[model samples]
Target: MNTNTIEREIAIEAPVERVWSLITQAEHLGTWFGDAGANIDLRPGGALEVRWDGHTLIGTVDAVEPTSRFTFRWHQLDTPAGADLTEQNSTLVEFTLTSEGDTTHVRLVESGFGSLALPAEQQVAMHADHSGGWPVELGHLKDHAAVVAA
Candidate 1:
């Protein structure tokens, strides 16, 4: 596993289409990703904003292949609201879904930490924080998917 990237996978007891809808739709994103809310355009190069605890993280869609892949880039460090989020200041997040029988495998990858223009310590801390966060977030997603499937 690359130190600059965080990767995680979860097997959800749901169909590919159901898992895709939970991951891509703005309303469903709020439950598993951002508790406050989310607003997404749902297309390549579309805008995505996830709100949590009064802060909104802005992102840009990179890919949207239904039930297969979804990718985006978002700022990894704290920046002023409305700041332009470019690759230089952001990290790439990718989600790939695969269907296995009755279950859907969801894989998440977040990379580009080494390129951020931040102190080395802060970069390490940020990486560690996200490393610990993905599993918890994926757990929430898995739980939600199970509930919805029930």
Candidate 2:
């Protein structure tokens, strides 16, 4: 892999505190991001596991800075078949919340793509997969927050 990273950002029409609460809440996550029953322990070094449908994603909380920033380490099962594959990846997903007056800028910066347990080609493909995935997730987050704020 070329050690390249994928990043996506979205401006939410909500305050930093509102955005932060949505991301940290496991029940809200399930309603918008993953399976409806997913559970999250929002503490550093805690378990972050989500069992969505038949796919399971398990990770650990790496960093948490109140309603400002949070990072995690993840391992996901399953992907688009024949695109690329890795059993585990020591990747970093960071959520940075910055407020401009009333709106909050939510930036999702995911790095360490080359640390995945797969061939260089596969790692690159996985990066591509996430490159698209994060935007959709953020869109969902934005809409969810807007509804809650309303």
1-150 in candidate 2: lDDT tens per residue?
344577788998888888888887887777567755567788888777666667666677889999899888776434453232232546778899899988999888888777666787888888888887888888888888978853
What's the C-alpha lDDT at position 143 in model 1? 82
What lDDT does candidate 2 reach at residue 100? 93
Clashing pairs for model 2 are none
True-vs-predicted CA distance for residue 120, candidate 2, Å: 0.9
True-structure lDDT of candidate 2: 0.76
Those runs of model 2 whose alpha carbons end farther than 4 Å from true positions after fitting are 1-3, 76-88
Clashes of each: 0, 0
**Positional deviation of residue 136's Cα in model 1 after best superposition, in angstroms:** 0.7
Tens digit of per-residue lDDT, candidate 1, span 1-150: 466889899999899999999999998888788899899999988999988878777898899999999999997767887787775689999999999988999999999888899887787888899999899889988988888753
As a TM-score, model 1 comes out at 0.92
